[model samples]
Target chain A: MKTKIFGAATLWLLACGPAAAESITWWVPNWDEEAARELVASYEEANPGYDVEIVITTWDTMAQRILTAMSGNNPPDLITELQSRIVLYASRDMLTDVTDWFDRDLAREDFIDSALATGTFDGRLYAVPFRHDGSGLIYNRDMFEDAGLDPEQPPRTWEEFVSFGEALTVEQNNVITQYGTAWPFGNLDNAVVRYLQLLYDGGGTFFNADRTGVELDSPAAIDAMQRLTDTILTNGIAPRSSLEIDNTGLRELFANERIAMFKGGPFDVDPLVDAGMNIGTATLPGTGGIGTTTVDGFSVLVPGRANNPEAAWQFAAFIAQPDSQTRLTATFPANRIAAENERFSAPLLQPFLAQLDEGVPKPSAEGWGEMQRILFDHMQSILLGSATVEDAMMSANEEINALF
Target chain B: MKRSTPRRGFLARLRTDKDGEWAPFVLPALFVSVLLTVYPVGSLVWTSLTNIGPDGVQFVGFANYVELFQMPRFARILGNTIVWTLLTTLGALILGCVAAVALEHRAVVLPGVWRAILLLPWIVPQVASATTWKWFYSSEFGMLNHMLMTVGIIDAPVAWLSSALVVLPAVALVQIWSTFPFVMLMVSAGLQSVDESVLEAARLSGAGPWQEFRDIVVPSLRGVLFIVSLVIVVWALNSFTIIWVITQGGPAGRSSIFSIYVYESFRNFDLHRSAAASVVLLVASLIFAIAYMARLRRQS
Candidate 1:
């Protein structure tokens, strides 16, 4: 009896060992690194032997470095990526298909199945999300009040947005001193993300369900891209200078009070608050019949040569649980129970939590990575007033079509 | 062994009889030349033929060449590259030569101070210089517009980098400004070697100042000019950092040149395109070098 008891205890400890013993490399992008660091510290304290080594890089270099590392012998044990990108890596055979891992350790029933679907491509789970992402209109309360617009009433519809954006647009000496609203088209991902949200809100398809071709040249999309382009060039609500700024650059400008209303993710608010802005946040504007937001988050994965896949799965499952997901949740908690908790109902956090139903992962196309550059050059041309909307979209469509 | 010694004597008997000692020096140089130049170039030529796109490479047998010639982007890049190299070289050469001639007289308040200041640009790191220029072009809060507005030169800050019409000139200005010091140093060294007696002889003849410079000083500096031009062309072709840091070959590929194009092709995981682009540049440089050498021979 004593021998059997001792053997059982050893098995239990070995099974529970990842929470205790393995050091994993966790690649973190430009999100809240400080919060991620704090999240890991508590984990280290709870689990004695295991610690995560955080490899930090900016957004531009992150994708390249991750791809470079995957080709080498040892890849990161855990990677944080947007929901849209989870499938791209899995398709490349760079990730572990965690279908059985999720079955034995976790389940879609335990987390928000829709959000988890982003990490699942073709019935195999590739990533487990750690945080949430949803974009909305973040405006300057002071600017709105000063401009004599209602601080409580942000734009609710597309038509309203155009007029609202125009009201805040201030000019001096025939040059716009302040921009009303702007979407930065500098980085390929952000442009795609924001555009995806716009298209979805406008009742459009990013691609056909099979992901065979682009739906960009469709009449609805032409209207959306054209109107968006018009908001800057023809409407004069946004400045042409916006094309020069990337996401971070745009956020910095917002923090510095150069832009009046910023349409960005929940991660943007804290920085503005830190910069001492009287900021107001809300759900991103909607159109047609549906209100849409892009649901994106990072996830942890087990690379090949994981010292123990079982242990990695246990930790991944444990983190997906409400206990861990709630604590680690910055924008979206994958756990439905954790997402509804009052603890996540803070000012900007409320929008991300509230917008969960509207959130959909941006489509993951096979050659979507190359398609981004094709999109960027054309988007830039449109923004810089180099080409008409039709011509620019046509060039973009042709280039994207060639990617196959 | 005795016959070997006599072979050198016989080789002297073969050609250039008095200069048999050159055989030893020339033979080692020939061996070194084959090892250094021939092997790497042979390898480069081999790789240039293969389609080595970002992921990995496969042998494609001139497919990279065919693709390169067909791409309109490559033609645009090639044209921009020619303009960039010519403008930078000619601008620097003219400015450098004039400064060297002027400074030779020691006319500045403190000639040593002025010379030290001139060398400052050359000593500055390329990245640091590029970064400074990038800030100066920044639209949000650049000092260029502050100065312009202060003087009432323009009502608003001109978008220097974002406009295609202005970007190439802006990039060329950076290159000419940063590299002129190098030309100055080279031309200064060459100018010091010009025979003062030749200047006196030209004046003694019917030649005026312009004729004197054209006939005497220029001919004397021919070797240095040829070398500087050759190096400048290669430098300009291969340079990626300044343009990469500043315009990023942007304002709609207006400032895009061969190096930036090659680097971007590699950046986007299109390695075959990069290799092909690099081979094109290598061949262009070789053609320039050969032309320069022939010119040197003819001038001599």
Candidate 2:
């Protein structure tokens, strides 16, 4: 009788013990970790059956870590990868198709078209866009005031942009104490993005209509390339040391008053303000025609190695919701409804939203990685005066075409 | 008794004689070597012959090698690698020997402090050194350019890292600074083995300082110099951190070496091409090793 009672008691104890909660690992870029953690905490609170682990990664190391993890058969359940890498990841089948999640669980029509298009590859959703950024001009109002240019009326045409820059530049005995603008000709990622914007602004595209071939050597594109490089070499408005700075480096120079202006987005404003600077925003100047800029962003994706796809998808869907995006610290939300929230309509972020209205997503073609690499080399050649615009364009087009 | 002979043969196979005793001692080392070096190298060889792409892995054989050879940048990359390795190795050795001899001289004071200060570059972390050097090499605001400008050396800032003709030497200067301490330490040790009396006799025989150094010191340090140079050549050839952190093999790849090409390939998910590049690099390193070992054998 006592043994029977004891067995019943043991069974009762076993039943009372806590069940193992399903856990999913998330790798996010360093910038969005705090927002991600808050969202994850809310997710765990709302869904008691799961736990989450967030690993912070940077852009420089994200690709490498993801590659290693995928190949090692130990990939995180979800990762936040940049938009440029989505096509590569999707083409390689490294990411899980989240089409059904988007279709069944969310209102797909509410997403910003460019943002959704960036995450879609070959008619399947491999990732969900979170925060999006596009290139625009951020100018120093104080420098504009000093140069006797109207601070309220930023340059809208390429000619005025160059003239304004030349006016704002400060030189002391041939050493530039304050550069008119810091164009990032050094780093490939920034340089290529700027180049793409210029190419698009000049009414040129990287590929033929069917996307079967590259057309980087087109006259319009070459003219665009020549004009951009000429701003540095021919006009002498840009610092020769411009090659020493990346996008962030340009922002730093602007913050420190070493540069008067540069290409950036709404996200750059707050940081520069926090760093104690007076900055203004404007649409990127156009080449006397319709303006265009390339959209760039980060996306949340579930790897094929996800241990808990259901739970991972749940997190992805939750994070893409308007509520979660509204809490993000920087970069405009990818959700149109969330981005339209009253707070984002502030004067500081409004220009970025306007710019995003006309922004085009990066090319989703398979050969984009190789194309970018070759373009970077050729762009540097032109910027450094080693190769002519015609020569660089021809060479880059030939190499990029060979890849296709 | 007849069956005992078979057992005795097995025991003799495991004998600890002069030749066979090393087997037991080296077994663990061999196991580690196979695990770390031999196994990875074998995997690299296998991977080089396979294309692990979007379609998954398949044997493609020499296709990757053919493509790599036909790559337009291959010749330039090879030339850059050779120039970088040779210049960095030679520059470090010359600078190190001079510093070592000067520090070892009797006229020098605070030798210990000087030695510690000289070794600071070697002791500091590579990432730190690279970051510091990046700041130092900055064109408009860098201390190097700033100092030169302050002294009225030039009216304009020199584009140390941007100009193609100047970038190779600029990067080599950083490599030399970071690496000379290794050569210094090695040469300092070699100097300890030099006979002071031999130097004294040379000096007493009406030999000036230059003659004493040429006649007595140079011959004594030849073997040390040779070994240091060979090691440094291999190290500089394989160097990635300094160049990667500083220039990222850019300003149009004027400073790119073989390792950067391999790394870029790997980063781009071109595993077959990366593996093929790795194999070629391994072969080049092996040739250096073979040449070094053959020279050492001849000297012995």
Highest DockQ among the candidates is held by which one?
Answer: 2
Candidate 2 per-residue lDDT, tens place, B39-67, comes to 99999999999987557788998999999
- Compose the digit string of candidate 2's lDDT tens values, residues A256-299: 78877788977788888887788888888888833578997888
What DockQ does model 2 achieve? 0.43
lDDT of 1 by residue, B1-300 (tens): 355443456555646756566677578988999899998777767777876345765788988889778764667777889899999889888887887777877456776677779988778988889878866875644678668877999887787776767777887888888888888889889988999888998788878988978888899888888888887877888888788777667655678898887766665556566777788888988988888889878879
> How many residue pairs clash in all the candidates, one count each?
2, 0
The TM-scores of all predictions, comma-separated, are: 0.79, 0.90
TM-scores, chain B, all models: 0.82, 0.88
lDDT of 1 by residue, A286-352 (tens): 7843358877777777765554565566566656666567777666687676676777777766765
Reference A-B contact fraction recovered by candidate 1? 0.07
Tell me the spans in candidate 2 whose CA falls farther than 4 Å from its real position: A1-21, A71-74, A288-290, A341-346, B1-28, B53-55, B290-300
Candidate 1 vs. true structure, TM-score: 0.79
Cα RMSD of predicted structure 1: 6.7
Residue B172 of model 1 has an lDDT of 85
> Once all C-alphas are superposed, what RMSD does model 2 give against the true structure?
7.9
Model 2 misses residue A219 by how many Å? 2.3
